[model samples]
Target: MADKPMLDDTEDVALDFGAEDELDRQRRFRHPVAVFFHLAFRVASILVYLLCGWFVDSFITSFVLIVILLSMDFWTVKNISGRLLVGLRWWNYVDEDGKSNWVYESRKGKLKGLTTAAESRIFWLSLVVCQVIWLVFFFGTLFTLKFKWFMVVIVGSLLNGANLYGYIRCKMGSRKKMTGVATNFLGAQVWRSMLATATASAAGKE
Candidate 1:
């Protein structure tokens, strides 16, 4: 008898078949489910922070809950949601020299050719809006002089800032790549023109 397929492998294959034409693979922003959860998680994180601080009236519990939710949101957005929504992914790692380096990867080929206007608009707008909201929350905490809440806001803001930086860097990389292509195209055109001129000069001499 043939060996049976592993349940895990079967499940994976089934899921792949279900989403065979994943929009992200086409570099299109068509993930209603992912986008829904992405926004839901972000909104829920802040709501929970507020609930713990105001309604529950427990400093320790509030602080812990806020930190955990924020952490989850950070990971989900950075890894899963960003990739699904924008076709961009980023990570940072420390080298043997103890220097940290960030890597930004973007989908290329036909997926890249599909373009990024819609994704970029949503991605950048979300970042800006999140930063602004977090900043407002930071000031609100400051008014209350709650050191713990302030700390939470600071951490959340830093995470948002880092995301913004990574995305901007990724976009810059795309721009540089495009610029290189344009330069090469112009150079080839110039070369072709030079060849034609030389050919004409030779014909005249002949």
Candidate 2:
């Protein structure tokens, strides 16, 4: 009897992670257009920063261009890509306490599922690889005392971190909600069993 709750919890988790009806999962991935733009702009940002230094001899112009690209990449990924790909969104806020906080939001719907597990895997992998390469560049600049390159690295890191945080928070929130559902189900079952026992006892005495 003690094991029943455990079994129920396990079953609930399984349902939470269950594969949906194939027909439902098909013909969609939330927003395909947004995903394309997300990847396109991400690549463009990196290329623009690298090319700006390589092809443009004017340091000030290159810096300005790279900064703009970084901002665009950050906005697109946070506001569009994250939501479309994982049904998650995050933003920053300042409260009366004058402290900065990051607010994360996610939806719980079958429609909230990622287009495909592979898509998310590839997308996140790409971000990790890109960030690692930038980190390598960052260290190289640090050792060389190349402040010019360092500035670009800083911007890249901030953008990459934002995307990473959004995806992770989304995943975690989903898991938390699923676990809560399982717990609630278990509690309701116990309550009903107790209620049934009391009703039967009263009827026997009548």
On TM-score, the leading prediction is 2
| Regions of model 2 farther than 4 Å from truth | 1-30, 95-101, 173-206
Checking candidate 1 for backbone clashes, the offending pairs are none
The superposed Cα distance between candidate 1 and the true structure at residue 46, in angstroms, equals 1.7
Please write out the lDDT profile of model 1 over residues 1-206, one tens digit for every residue.
99997676443333565354555534565666666666766677678866664588677777777777777777877887777677778899999999999898887776764434565566668778888888999999888887767888998798877887776677688788899999999999999999999999999999
- Name model 1 segments beyond 4 Å from true: 1-29, 96-98, 113-120, 174-206
Pairs that collide in candidate 2 are none
Superposed by TM-score, candidate 2 places the C-alpha of residue 174 at a distance from the truth, in angstroms, of 6.7
lDDT of 1: 0.76
Best candidate per lDDT, number? Answer: 1
TM values, all candidates:
0.63, 0.64
